[model samples]
Target: MVDWSGGNDRGAVPKADAIWAGVARGETVEDPVYLRNRKIAEDWIGAFLEDELAAGRRVLAGFDFPFGYPTGFCAALTGQGDPLALWDWFAEQIDDAPDANNRFDLAGQINRDLVGGKGPFWANGLKRDVPGLPRRKDGYVNPFPERRLAEGQAKGAFTCWQMAGAGAVGSQVFMGLPVLSRLRRRFDAAVWPFEPLSAPIAIVEIWPSLTVGPAPSGTIKDAWQVAEIARQVAALSAETLTQILDVNAPEEGWIFGLGFERLLRGTPAPLRNDCFALPTGVHWTPVDEAMELLRSRLSPVTGQETVDTADALGRISAATSFARRANPPLPNTAVDGYGFAGGRPAGAQVLPLVQGRAAAGDAPGAVPAGQAIRVLTGAALPAGVDTVILQEDVTVRAGAIHFQGPIKAGANTRKAGEDVVAGAEILQAGRRMAAADLALLTATGVSQVRVRKRLKVGVLSTGDELVDAGQKAAPGQIFDANRPMLLAMIRQFGHVPIDLGRVGDDADALRARLDSAANKVDAIVTSGGASAGDEDHVSAVLDAAGAMALWRIAIKPGRPLALGMWQGVPVFGLPGNPVAAMVCTLIFARPALGLLAGADWEEPQGFDVPAAFDKRKKAGRREYLRARIRAGRAEVFASEGSGRISGLSWAEGLVELPEAAMQVSAGDVVRFIPFGSFGT
Candidate 1:
């Protein structure tokens, strides 16, 4: 349990009543920790969570602040039923500075709109009077007539709407919600009532007053309350704890150990069975299983195309190619010299010149025994000739050619089928014709080649806040980074990329755009709107169409993949984060697209190398960390946040951790995949 605060730093010495933290693990309950400032507290909490998670321990942290405001307050402020939407809404509206904040002023503005006068929240402690703020409560009105159920149930609990008085929790609500949102983002955790309970790390609300009595002697009440709450919550059985969580309302989150007030009173609690308070583990699709499933469901379309050898570069071969005829069907002279029938001793190199010269493409008639023929390079030699002496080393004296160098049989002569035999298999089917390969094919007497037709793939980006790069960006707007990026990736993968442009969050616009693309392209790839959110409409649009599949895979920087068919054309939906979109496109979509285009499945190759740093990972998920091989050691980025585009830029490759792989120490061997393997 953590005692949260809204004020600035408590310098030098930690305040006796400021921020405090407590922990209970196994049968041991630790003392409450003191945090003098917000920055220190945040740092300490982040570090502690990382340590516990890295050690393969489950952490369920409790914060002593309201997770939700009064009833009807959220619906009146933001049109959303789920309390998480409100957390995100507050996260967006509030601007937090470490030293200070505008909580009082923001509360005043909310009061002006909700109450139409000084009200609901009216007390101010600031030196300057903000607009719509009442310095003192004289005729203040309350917009919300009732306190929240959780607050009402907990006796002596302060109202969330009150601003600046003793026991007032208004500032904590203004400040804590945003901090909680950021904390949830920083770790692989879940916020109570806002996110799923499957995560090992849980951030839940706690009201000590609801379960704690006065402090023991020689200890502060703030710290004692924290210790008691953590101890009591940890001691409850899983069956009992889960019942409380499941029965709690989603809009109004429940306090921990709410009904077990007297079970562990005034004493240390005991450990229970291994049953978890929430879901025990994560279940994700294996990489190979997913690949085979896609391959089995999709039909391979490989239309044939006949093209000249010059136009066949980078095209997949449709059929095996064989040599039409042997290279140099007859024996030929490899040099411009005198061709002799003398396979005699090494000293017998003198021969008389013949009457006719054997120029290139000329087949001189059979030479009589003991006779010699003068032949040019590439000219077919006479039947009786087996050796040739270079003209540069021979002299034409009188009527004979002479050489001083030693002569061997078959010297300077090319035999039949020396380079390629007739009807020999040269190029195999499904081979991507490279420049050298194309040249070699032509040399083997190939003129026209058959290849598979290039696939037309459409790339699309969806989000209400996204716009074209060249267009001016307004507030809360970003350029369409995913479409252009994925388009480049698709083109680089040897398929044609068709730009489907950007569509907003509206499902109708997305449906029309996808339909149009389905008519023009064989496959479509979209990024964003693949997660479970109200703004996610791509899945809904595809659902209306004939076939649509959505999946949740356990991989970092990659969300669930959405696969379906639109008018016989395959569609791939990637995550909205630019880095995640790129990773998914390469790891999963690239292979799936290759299968659809009738290309062979190629697994990426990786090397086992030592790690440069230590890492703690979840057991049940396959994770890829952006890293670079530095001095033969795989080093990952300091920050793993997907939004940092520079992480992708700095990474030369990825360090892959397999499912069931856990903590890794420096110098531990890990599999590393280079980016070149993906053809990036």
Candidate 2:
């Protein structure tokens, strides 16, 4: 562990707030070393790593400063969203020495020329002013978020913008990153999460405060912190180390041990297994009624697990997720222009400009009376600033801004809590987390959440004339297509799929397969032998198990739907034909699996569109024809046969014909359901 410093060299004697390094090996930890300056520390670290690598030993070195800036700040600086690129850029620009360095000047140049100026880096501790650098935190504007995702989770952590005040870390980052960039090039070292975790030399960003305790009397706090943190990290189990390294922050590098605290606390709760027994006595049921029955009777059977927000997509929220902090955390500008406090003006007006501009992520400053300050988009609005005028509407002449007004008092100003308020629920329980949801959750300071465990749904195909795919089939046998199709569907619906390979038609074999699947998966979906024939073993086995319900649904291409429980696990028995099986799975099993996986019970919505073909049918049973939209009209496949598997691939969606069928003309409007509505 390295406790880095950005100040000038501390001569001869060892002291606190200076550079310190602690090394730990198996069953041994060496005394901390104090390096007087950056040049000395860099030389020592490089030599130490080289010797360790020569001895064929792996070394994990850590530094205490931030590895990268906030998300957009890197892209704005390097023209790419890469932290290493920014590191290289800093290495090329910054010139460091033992006593005097150009860090403040570089920061000023970055603020003024590189990015639209004002401030992102501030607190220039020099006696005289540098061009674009500010003497106080409130003087500069930031063009990015104030903190990274990792920083948001780390309470009491200082933002990497304060350069030379108490708890300031900005100066250290500006100095340390350049050294790391050079060392990585010298020794091809992997930085965690950005580059995969690997052998010879690896550098990680760490915060010793997370694990350090009170220092021993008379010992330097920085030295004690580095020693203890290094020892702790070196002693971690391989599994724990891998978990800590398995993060997804490339641009904004993650802090070591930030989200893995709970993992070391305890094991997770066991999964729940409540048998979902379907109701009996349903003969020739309508599609709507069947759906309602499933929704009312089924509930989630999976337990919950807490995961980092970076890995939470597609998981179902276990509880309502609330914002930890208000979004727009501070009131900010909505456009690039000038901000000033005053009521709407009548016509043309001119005001003196403030010395500096304001950008996003910078501390909010106060605007003087009758004065305007240049503000970039997302920049925090200065105090006394209630409105902003677009740059196109203004002209700069004689050190003053001139613009025609009558603009609203709060125009182009986004208020704090404008998007989300702190403690307000952002996602409700049973909602499937999406990409956009992650953005909202992170921006509001939500780092981790409890999500339902993915449900493992097994697919089993049974028939005497069946063979697995990729094998030469015998006479009178065909490759099993239902298993692969159903497995993909299970994954598409956000559930885990377990393949329970083909089983021949036999009562004992079918029973054994069902019994094995009950222990391995949360639910089983078997295609074939669903009807009550002498050879139909799926329904026969369910009947023998004493929890079977065969629903004769009033739908074409699908009718015999068998629902049952086998050894405490639910089972959905579908028809053998591929086309019929797919239709039934979408209509009945998709929503059921979603509910079992802890998501809301969703019904696929359909809309009416013009029909391109004309047909007449009797009014007894509902029908769904495999169709696609052509010229804004529904055009169905040539074949309506259940055995036409090619039709399933050819059609984009299904056109529904109601129970009271009265279709006659080609111009008639028909209800069409897209495959995407079923999450395909």
Candidate 3:
């Protein structure tokens, strides 16, 4: 992560307010490097992110300040719905020239444009009086909320609304977004929740207050604050980092430690030589990093067997497959026409039709000089055959066929191996064979194929309050929706689902159930009982057994995930809430199970569609709102609460909100993932 500054150059000395950068890789966080100017900072950040990414390491970067405005402010000011778009626009509007910048002038211009002459922005640090901008807060109406959501959450957090106050972050927002926009564009990095979570470089809006507490007497506050942040980030375990990345608030960005604020202890990670001490404070993990770590550690199912080509449809190939034979095994006719030989145009004038005709599977005798052979589509081309002409294009009279003028040579003639060559790779390993693949294989004379063994997955439903759907729910009990849903999804993905049924919140019972299923299944999946509650016993069991890393992902509707090994069999624990459980199963567990089942990583490709409604979200966390496309725009479910099971049921798919503070207007582009894309 890189610390940022928004102030102008601080003469040759880098002051506390000036931008200082610190990079933390594992346990070692380098000293805060001074960047005297914005230009130097921009170029340095770009180069650093690139260098880190190029080295094949994932970069979880954070910038100090609000990456976006509070809710609708960005969309209102710029007429752009996307948060990153606002960043780019803000960056382009600002003119930072090292020694001096137009921060006050830009503030005045923004105030004029947003609120006419009287404005919410106040306090001019500029020595000169700027028109429209105020010297201090007076009677001007504040168009935006007094503080961002995160600022409101954090006690003593500075107000970003003020332009010139002691704790004002107005300059930071104005100056910071421009550089961030440039960095994002230059690196093609993902700006948190706005983009898909696949990019190598991820930029986040960081608040130093998130990691720093009240300083002691005689301490340099700024230096100590920067050091504290570097230490905290350095101590971030893979699991903790994963959880942080999981919190994707694109529009209303979240503070890094919003949820984990209580978990933060000043266990600083020390700076050493090149090597870093084991990552400390490993309480949470980011969703993306957890997935990669899971994928890298999992070994694909080893069983392989041959299946008849008829059964190859929807089966993943275990090895690279090649064609048994070339398509059109021999030269054949492509149309119901006459087969023209060497005498082509000479015979075109008037050629004697061959007595023996070539129909499907029948070879006609070679045509002699000045002769034509009558052939039907798919009929084998006889010796000396060059082309086939459609019967409609030729007129047959008195046993002689006359063709149209200027028929190209070899027209409508299908050559052997034209479609597919023998011994050529047709299907790759780990490909879930489609119907088209089977049809192609059959056409190439393949009778059987080798495919990975189907995954035998055990599905369990945990929660004492969960009852099967067929049974009536008793008091305080809810229907077990996740189990059936997960089972159906597993089956739809071509894996055999082993139903473990509904297990109560008893940890011993859950552990016993897991032990029994260990040898019977390749992997185990449980829905519910993974979150932080008195009833959340699933994570407690895993933690006690030292079985897996529990995940507190930064996603709405689904945040709790437990992954571990039970008696050598990998197990995935989903959230207790039905909607969150389903989402976690689909997004994380599905890909993970596929990897274990010997399938390549299959991610649902999202389409960009306009939003049908206005959405306000903070930066630093990702929320997948249950939504559907209507009239070419994405409309989210009225409620995005995690426990709302009906939301997922109503949605055709999900509208992914990026990590940032944004107020999305109707017709704004949003990434949409359809249910059909997820096989289940």
lDDT of 1 by residue, 321-374 (tens): 776667767788999988888655656456777788888888567777776878
Per-prediction tally of clashes? 0, 5, 44
Model 1, backbone clash pairs (residues 3+ apart or across chains), number? 0
Candidate 1: stretches off by over 4 Å: 1-283, 328-330, 333-338, 341-343, 346-348, 355-367, 373-382, 386-408, 411-413, 605-614, 629-635, 662-671
Q: By TM-score, how accurate is candidate 3? A: 0.58
Instruction: Give Cα-based local distance difference scores for all models.
Output: 0.77, 0.85, 0.76
Which numbered prediction scores highest in TM-score against the true structure? Answer: 2
Question: Order of candidates by lDDT, top first?
Answer: 2, 1, 3
Query: Can you write out model 2's per-residue Cα lDDT over 155-178, one digit (the tens) per residue?
Result: 878899778889999999989999
Give candidate 3 misplaced runs (Cα > 4 Å): 1-284, 343-348, 363-365
Q: Highest lDDT: which candidate?
A: 2
Question: In candidate 2, how many Å is residue 544 off?
Answer: 1.1
Candidate 3: Cα lDDT at 168: 80
